[model samples]
Target: LPDIEGELCRIERVRDVLVRRESELRYMMDDIQLCKEITRLKKELQKLVSIPDKDKLKEDREQEEELLLQINKLVETRDFLVDDAEFERLREREEDREMAASLQSKIPKALAVQGESDHESVI
Candidate 1:
């Protein structure tokens, strides 16, 4: 009877361990699935956002290059009259460039924050 009881206890311990391991595996599977879903959603979001903006971004870049070329030509000529209006226009363009740069810098930080929030929410 003592040997039988000991065998039964051993079986129960093994059963418990197996049950715990099964639950842990299920949790890991769930985590993997969630990560895959998050990755899919992020890709979809990027596709949606980037597709339309690509053309616009390309156009803007071309325009900026043209503007830079014109500015360089003006500088080379050294005969450009900097009236108040021209000066103001140049200053405004510089400000716009600065603002665009700052916004571009913030975009990655914003995405990082958003990613952190998403991870926290998943947990």
Candidate 2:
């Protein structure tokens, strides 16, 4: 007759080993899921931190543009003032030259008139 009791014991031992291996595999799979969750959370954190940096960069760009606009306005104003001063200087120089010419012509006519009066008194 076969030893049925021993055979049954041997089969139970094999079943127990399979069940333990399955438990270990389940634990390992749970760990893998936990690792994936941690990685996703880390990525989310990085994005949150970078959002402020992006906003700051946008603000800096706007400020730089404003400064450039101010600089351009100052340059234009300087150019206008310089042009006005140059035009005024030229006009004043032209007026002085005209006044000198008029004075010189009047002086010669007055000298001629004086000489004629003297010659008639001597005769």
Candidate 3:
């Protein structure tokens, strides 16, 4: 009878230990689920934080496009100015040639008149 009682006591102690261990495992599983939820929330937060960066990048791209357009317009204006300067230079050169031709024709007439006056005085 005493041996049977000892065996029953050992079984009860083992069952108690197993119950305690089961509770500990339940607590650990709950902790694991909480950690997973926290990790998911952190990822969501990171995505939310990056939203502003994405918007800023989009705005920067738009500004860069506007600047490129302005640069192209400036280049076109510069090209027009260069062409106008070349045209003005060509016009001035033509005027100078015309003036030189007129002066040459007048010089020959004046020389012939002087020669005639000299011959009359000599005769």
CA lDDT of every candidate: 0.61, 0.62, 0.63
Which one wins by TM-score: 1 or 3?
3
Could you estimate the TM-score for every candidate? 0.42, 0.48, 0.49
CA shift at 48, candidate 2, in angstroms?
25
RMSD of each: 30.0, 51.0, 49.9
What are the runs in model 1 whose C-alpha is more than 4 Å off? 52-123
Write one digit per residue (lDDT tens) for candidate 3, span 1-123. Answer: 846975985797578667656755665565566456555645544554556654656665565556555545555655665565567557756855885687689779878998999999999
| Top of the candidates by TM-score | 3
Candidate 3 stretches with Cα past 4 Å from truth are: 1-56
The true-versus-predicted C-alpha distance at residue 60 of model 2, in Å, is 2.0
Q: Per-residue lDDT tens digits of candidate 1, residues 20-60?
A: 56755665565566456555545544444555554656655
Candidates ranked, most accurate by lDDT first: 3, 2, 1
Instruction: List candidate 2 stretches off by more than 4 Å.
Output: 1-56, 120-123
Per-model clash counts, in order, read 0, 0, 0
Model 1: colliding residue pairs:
none
